[model samples]
Target: MKKLFLLGILSLFLCVLVGNVALGEEEKISIAYIGASTDLPFWITLRNEARNQANELGVEFIDLTPPSMDAQAQKNSFDNAIQMGVSGIIVGAADSRAFDDSLDKASEVGIPVVAVDTGIDHPHIASLVQTDNLSSAKIAGQYILDHMTRPGKVLIIGGVLGHQTGDARKNGVTEVLEAAGVEVIFRAADWLPEKAYEVAQNELAANPDLTAVFAAWDPGAMSAKSVVAERGLTGKIIIVGFDGDPANLKAIKEGEILATIKQDNVKMGRDSISLLVDIINGKEVPKYIPIDGFIIDQSNVDEFLQ
Candidate 1:
């Protein structure tokens, strides 16, 4: 009878020990991604890559992108993710300064925040993963200066006026073209294709002899290409773009656009997750990670397909 009682107690003790071990095991990390605009292919591709990387790493991924490019909406999403106790956050900021308070709150609560594509001016950002937009924009500017046939009017379709990425690109292009004595007509399309198309259509009709057009973002470039094609100025007016969207790749193949700078968006997404993981693991990470960009033109556009 004593032996039976001892055996039962031993079994109960072993079960408790096993349960404690199971409870002590590390839980899967949860990552929250606050994308700027889901409507943009660039952000969509970035989100997809980040989600894939999170899945590969056995982490839970949450997408918190706003319906549109609304800054306040983005901040609300960040706050919600923080409230949900996310392990980390990868954000493509809609506005550089709008998320400062939410980022600060995340930092205070020990949830690391990494910025991707666009960056904020706040010190709370754990790391920034993006391309050097200014330098890449200069590439397009130099191409226009070297290849433009004449000194006729040149138009620039830029992103949001005060946005960091757009401002950097516009400044870079403006500097290079102004130094080359080219007349630049700058317009902000807010990164909207329809608005870009409207601007391009009106300008193409008015300026007829516009020498070149630089669309600082991929979708804007796509819209500009449509206007140029409709006006029968496909090969005549040099059209350069920024992001390497798949449609832009197709446009390059069809000779609709002259060239575009390809930002490593997949790397941007993957790196953001990697850095956040490192941070979560109590490892040091670089504050800034700059990915390289490629200039895609007809000569090498075939290799970029697929």
Candidate 2:
């Protein structure tokens, strides 16, 4: 009986030693990318960059962006990521406050979340990696002030309602234009080019002498440019856009768009992944990570094109 008891004790000690060794070995972690609609160019680029970064870091990446920017759909994807037991989550929310409950649940489960491009007001968000959109728009508004000699009417086209990015950009433009004594006409396009075109057409009909236009997104800028061209007011109306998409940059080169604010979405994606990895590895990270944006216009358009 004494011999048997000693053998049992020895076996237990070996089991504990093995368990410690296993714990010391690096374990592969999986991260979920909960992006906005993949159809949107900005979100697509962001997602691709995050995926590439995850691959470089040797972490499993799962994409969960919905086909459209629906709040419920994004919530559902978040729930799925939680169920899959991902180590971290990177999100570009469709709506600012739509993912509060889901994010709270992630926190409860100890899954760290990093917001990219769009952010929520949840306490659990580990970091926000995005451009300073408001400041960029303010720069665009300043461009309008410098160019539009006359303080006449100007139109402001925006994306969907309640979209944090759109609202911030619009607020920035409004602040500068209103201060410069420019009459501004505002409209929300819901991120639809057709709606933006229609609104631009109607606004132009009512205010034919409009001096300039501030489009809060690239698509809206394209639509506004089309309207200006159709009305034979291309050179007369200065159209500025947010989101320096390639097409918008082309437009800028062609003089259709006077200028656009370039959001570093790719950097935002890579940074979000890097921060999430740090959080998962028990490293400290800031609550907010700001990425700078630049104004791309005729003077600097060639440099961007190259």
Candidate 3:
């Protein structure tokens, strides 16, 4: 009887040990998010949503954002995530073409990547989830064409011309304005609001009859607004921006900004993670996922204010 009791206790101990070993062997997914400056509300929304989605999916979430908008810094973050052996990576590239070598390394290690907001041109990139800036900018351009004064001189401020997101937005607006015989001028701020302000200031000073201004991002729009306000041309000029940042949305509501394009950031944030997870799990995903954008003006801005 004593021997049987000892045997039963040993069996129970062995079962518990095996259960712990099984639990220990189970793997948890880890996805790393590489993003640009969170200084902007757009990045903030995207990162938060990605983090939330990671939590819900029971995956380890790693957010690696550069301290500044420097391209090299973002590349370093990407490299770090790769070295950490993360299951996958999501990048919001500051420069679309900037990550080739790092992407090559990721491919060597068989880790897939998903790009958000800005698309990276690399085979290792499994998917790109972002707004359809080309189509959306057309909406803003059409709105500008319908509202601006005849014989209007419009200035289109944007980032570097080669950047996929900025180029698409700039081209969409420029094509429409040019087709309508509107005098369209472009200046690159290199994604800096201060530079955008300088451009707006110089242009406004040089061309007193400028009718409308189209900015590729909300900060650029706000910068133009500052210059316009400083020059007492607030009510005289029409201004529109992209990104639909919360602060900019408030500006639209308050009638400070005439009109702006609102990208579906919420969808972007959620879908980026969803796509990355799919790619990590050996599931196929569309190479290019385009989210839509719409115009928000005072007429419908109140709908978004809440």
Candidate 4:
């Protein structure tokens, strides 16, 4: 009887040890990621990549995007993540200042916040993972200058006015074009395809002789391309944009877009999560982590497309 009792006790102890090990292995660290909009393929790809990376690391990633690029919707998402007690947050803020309060609340609750693609101006942000927008824009601008002999009027299809990425790209192009003595005709688009199309139509209507069009993003550029084709001005106007989406690559192949800047979005997602993980694990993180971008033109579109 005594021997049997001892065996039972030993078995219970072993079971407890095994259970603890299993629990440790199954321990999930929850992370929240919010983007401007999920409708854009670029953001979709970025979120998927981030989720895949989180899964590999035994982390739970919750991705949220507003129905549109609505600031209040993004703030609500941030608030929801905070209420759910997420370990960390990675946000591509719709507006830099819109999330300041929510970010502060997250910080108060001891949740580290990392910004990806777009940045929050608040100091409480743990880190920022984004491309060097200005440098990428400069590459596109140089390509345009080289492709067009001497400087004629070029249309600048600007993105959402206040968004950091859009503003940076516009400023970068403006700087480069001015330096190269190119006349820039400005037009505004809300970063929506429809809005971009309208802007493109208006620009073409005003400046039919425009030599080139520089769009802040790929979708906007593609929208502009469609309008250019509709107006029967395809070969006459060169189109350059940021973000080397696969569709953009196809456009380049078909001789629609001249060039695009390919951001390391996958790397951006991976690095942002890694940085947040480090902070959660009590490691110090840098305030800014800038990732560079590459220019994809006809000569190198094949490389990115493959």
Best by lDDT: 1
Worst 10 residues of 4 by lDDT: 21-30
Off by over 4 Å in 1: 1-25
Best by TM-score: 3
Answer with 1 or 3, whichever has the higher lDDT: 1
TM-score, every prediction: 0.91, 0.90, 0.92, 0.91
127-240: candidate 1 lDDT, tens digit per residue:
999999888888889988988987798899998888899988898888899998888899999887899999999999889779999998988998998888887778999999
Better of 3 and 4 by TM-score: 3
Candidate 3: segments with Cα more than 4 A from true spot: 1-27
Ranking by lDDT: 1, 3, 2, 4
**On residues 1-306, what C-alpha lDDT tens digit does candidate 4 reach at each position?**
999999999999999999998887556578998987888777877888888888888888898778577778999999999999988998987777688789789978899899999877887788999999888888888888889853478888886678788888888888898898888877778677888899888878887668899988889999999998998878778999888899999999889888898998888878888888888878998998888888888898888785
How many backbone overlaps does candidate 2 show? 0
RMSD of each: 3.0, 3.2, 2.8, 3.0
Per-residue lDDT value at 158 in model 4? 81
Error of 2 at 65 (Å): 0.8
Q: Lowest lDDT 10-mer window, candidate 3?
A: 20-29
Query: How much is 267 displaced in model 4, in angstroms?
Result: 0.7
Clashes of each: 0, 0, 0, 0
Clashing pairs in 4: none
Q: What is the lDDT of candidate 1?
A: 0.89
Better of 1 and 4 by lDDT: 1
Worst 10 residues of 2 by lDDT: 20-29
